[model samples]
Target: MSIEHDAHASGRPAITEGGPSLPQERRLVTAIPGPRSQEMFARKRSAVPPGIGTTLPVFVTHAGGGVVVDADGNSLIDFGSGIAVTTVGNAAPRVVERVRRQVGDFTHTCFMVTPYESYVEVCEKLNALTPGDHEKRSFLVNSGAEAVENAVKVARHATGRQAVVVFDHGYHGRTLLTMTLTAKNMPYKQGFGPYAPEVYRMPMAYPFRWPGGAENCAAEALAQVTDAIDKQIGAHNVAAIVIEPIQGEGGFIEPARGFLPGLLEYARANGIVFVADEVQTGFARTGHLFACEDEGLVPDIICTAKGIAGGLPLAAVTGRAELLDAVHVGGLGGTYGGNPLACEAALAVLETIEADGLVERARRIGDLMLPRLRALAERFDVVGDVRGRGAMTAIELVVPGSAEPDAAVTGEVARRCHAEGLLVLTAGTYGNVLRFLPPLSISDALVDEGLSILEKAISSV
Candidate 1:
């Protein structure tokens, strides 16, 4: 295979403003898992547990903009932004600068012991940026699961209710409580038994798979959800109704229009806190700053992570001030919840997103990728559906002439893309959806190249 370094291939600049200035092109100098990566994989198998799986197993030496450079010098177009953690791009200049300064000043003072300005600043940013204009309080954590766990804790504490309502096809986290809340069984929660209690499941407005056609999905789903809550869990006993605006692991399923609003109204009327899990859809990845903003759905609480800190391990739960304040002082905190370094990186990430116009960049990415994906759907019978918003997009794979999921074809396409030097990811409840989470800093040329690789992979499959 041959590699090109031209920026004009897709009529967009190759240079990234706040990220590493790599050539922004794909280059293959060896097989997918080159010698070095394979060697590292061997060591990883011994050192790491088999449970910790890898996507491509290509050891990355450096990654920036739209490309991840491997140890053997193979550069692959990054369609998955470290699972949507590097929205502003890896090693973003501002993040690097801020992290360096914070590391030099103080690494970890433990926010619970002695809070720092950066931590407070990050909370302030979260309070300001999250969905509602109502006064809100924010709590920081180390991961999405922690944010979610804390959100549930706050909701339960505020409402004095034990039951938590979760929707089908939602991916909360791997924690015991969140695992029970999540709908998927395999990989995330198969052997992990004796799960948390008081977690009730509800139907979601999955348009493609709805019993009625897509047109009637929202109303029907809403009715079913409300009815289920009333009959199964009793709305009065529910503490929170947690949902992902765009179900990430559940195949990037964006509920039909009005679905979220309907749920929010129900939650409000029933005194159930509505929690929007934006772990995968937040921080400008979905055109709007948060996917909830698209529907103008002001959730009672919003959980965020991934792109919040430019790849750092930081997550936050921002919600109405009264609810959050309901928790007793010192009741919500962690040893390394809001490390100074991570807080600094988050502040820089927010600034970079605003100054670099990453939100618009995400929309541009969707504009460039969605049409080509839809075209691929037209060409390939296996392409069941192509849907998403902004940079967070996906194509569902299904058996031809039917909606039955084809996980085999999905795996094959991803494998082929890996061999051809394109980094892609698969998602969905059935593992038949190919999700694309390209960095907001990716160039048009790289986007075109990645899509080309994906097209060939899908065709070959």
Candidate 2:
């Protein structure tokens, strides 16, 4: 019944940078997937694994700013950002320029074998930009999952402990170790059992679905986590407590105000490391360089990716020096961990974020979206809740009279949006949330048009 805002999530309007020269417009030239995409889908059915799924199989030939152009010539307004991977926009001018140059110079020479200055420079930037002013260290990896796994390894190595704690509705990743850390079941953890050991789950302060009500969510959720950690895992046994500042695949859920700080306090009080998995929330997606900066909640380790490198596959684990240093010299690394092309792309992403003032742009996006979604909620009873910070917003769909999730309706609305040439993504644990992650480079005109299409889609449904 109570609604609060993060004061840090508002600012002056932003002047976004230019990225991807593709014309930004929505034009549905054919049926949703189009014939070319259909052909590709048929090929995929024969060639690819069933486990690998897709939201819209439009067969993208080009993407930039706010539009993803399909092979059939349809230009769909993009609100998904390739699952929030292209925050600076796909084929961002800076990224393309840097990577094109880097590719000609050299591609891979793995950081471990030869090492590169770009890699070291990236670590320096991460150490400086991530939360906390303490002496920090950073190492690059290939994906968010790898960053999280490295964070866990660093925590365990530093604390000399065995157990790790995660929260309900939190999504880490799909790797064996991260799969064990994740809380979801069906798609992520169902048959992939015989999971790794020593990971515990805590209740997240998810206000909308908390047991009693939103008001009690913060206090109760905090108590439950501490109690569970103390009684079940024993405080001393916990090496790290990992959580997303804002849950992404598990439905962009932003925990109540007091919960994160409370958890951080407990972690510090015990000798347990606190890891902030900022994969989806980092890089100005949440109106701040890091989501933890909103509450001033500094974690011992922060995992970043998705938006870190425009569209490159790069991730990082930045943390207190002692923890990262605790890992043996060769304890952490991968064949493609800090590939030079990715490193160049990451540096370009950082430059683009700072130059474009994307943090302010994300704030402007939230200012534009939250009010519109809230107004839509008032018009439609199926809109159970509208929550998110900055451009990373979501609307939780529900049965008309109650909080029961309406995943069916969510799917239908998404399908409608696709048919109308609007690219949107559905998320949440129950799969009833529609999350929007527009590239910050997108013009306000495109954002308005996308929202209009979404409104029409919801109305039609």
Candidate 3:
């Protein structure tokens, strides 16, 4: 079929002529490096780095659906999903076609100078899709970090507050402000030094290790936060309480059910902006389009990225119209924040999510995987806790009953999983948690296959 015809069918303009799709049956003909990817990696290693390139012999010749075909022509089930950036799938047909068309027409005009319909359309979609019955607005950005930074800026600008409240084990981004907001210091904040001022950390309820167990964990955590916001950094002086509905990078820890609501209530009472850092948990990764939707506690601002543009770099802040509008005009944008290509891809991603029912797919992926992970936890002494929402699931590894993390074994498990033809990623302050970001478009068979491999890896570990 012609590209134009396919685009027309998919409700997008055509750009490139017919692009190829991967074969249905996965074929791993050679060792992962095969021959091609190794060559690319060697060439890249001289350019990339040992620190940057964690997965060695890394190069993908082709990827689609839930599998990555490496340069060696080895088809591996992709569970990391490009670090939760490709929820729909790698090279999703709709996203590819839309991006192609957009690139062909015009790539960058920089929304700051000459605005485009795609940017406006994406903002409109975000405003509509984001939780809340109140009037909403959106600001598009390049990456999750940028989105988060801008969200903080908006909150501070609106509330005229100097202090920001973040939770323990929370991760915002790598930027100055975001790094300050991030709880972990090593690597991200270590020597990165002199982080932005006024960023304070509070404890969060990790049911697995909360002093009072799940029953009083939420209340205890809430009391601690309320006290901090009320006494130390008066809520009046605090611009926002940034939180991840399901904490990412901090070990896929889901805040207790009432914890989020409690924080929101505190924010509402003190006129504090509640910022939901849905960077990793947004776009149906948590099964509800936005993880915040699970609690029905609408934040003053919602920072989103990762899966926003199907694979392209796109991030956004969606929230109350008044607060978002509070920022001075032109005070909240980047040169390539909402590039047309990214905007087109994002639109297609939203459509594909709706048309293809990917949110349901995420819920299904979670339903299928969680039980097995729970079972694994029961068997493994190091498996401290298995928790997460929807497709954004993780398993925290600890030393038996204690909260002491086992980063060594966690690293080993991840290494084994990768070697066994399954790509996985680890998170947490101690890096003892294995996070699963499988594509929502993944098939039941692929899910089962990946889990079986994971089971073997964990068993070996």
Clashing pairs in 1: 251-428
lDDT of each: 0.90, 0.88, 0.83
Cα lDDT tens digits for candidate 2, 1-461: 00012322432223234345577678888998999999999999999999999888889999877788999999989898888899887888788889999999998888889988999999999999998899999999999999999999899888889899998888999999999988889899999899999988888899999987999998999998899888988999999999999999999998999889988998899998999999999999999989999999989999999999988899999999988887888999999998899999999989878766778888888888999999999999999999999999999999999999999999999999888898899998999999999888776777888889889988998
Task: Rank candidates, TM-score, best first.
Answer: 1, 2, 3
lDDT of 3 by residue, 1-461 (tens): 01132332232222223323564334668766567876787788789766564553668877776788876778888888888998887888888889888878988988888899999999999988898889999978999999989888888899888788998999888898899889998778888888899988999888887988988889998998898778887778988888999888888998887999988988899888899999999998988999988988788889999999988999999989899887787787878899899999999989878866677767777888999999998898889899987898999899887879999999999888877788888899888999999887666667788899888998897
Q: Each model's TM-score?
A: 0.97, 0.96, 0.93
In the predicted model 3, the residue pairs found to clash are none
lDDT of 1 by residue, 1-461 (tens): 11113432443644544447566778999998999999999999999999999999999989887889999999999999899999988888889989998888888889888778988899898898887789999989999999999999999999999999888889999999999999999998999999999998888899999989999999999999999999988999999999999999999999999999999999999999999999999999999999999999999999999999998999999999999999998899989999889999999899878876777778888999999999999999999899999999999999999999999989999999999999999999999999999988787878998999999888777
Error of 2 at 232 (Å): 1.3
Of the two candidates 2 and 3, the one with more favorable TM-score, higher being better, is 2
Report lDDT (Cα) of residue 244, candidate 1: 94
**How far is 382's C-alpha from truth in model 1 (Å)?**
0.7
- Which ranges of candidate 2 are over 4 A from the true structure? 1-19
lDDT of 2: 0.88
lDDT of 3: 0.83
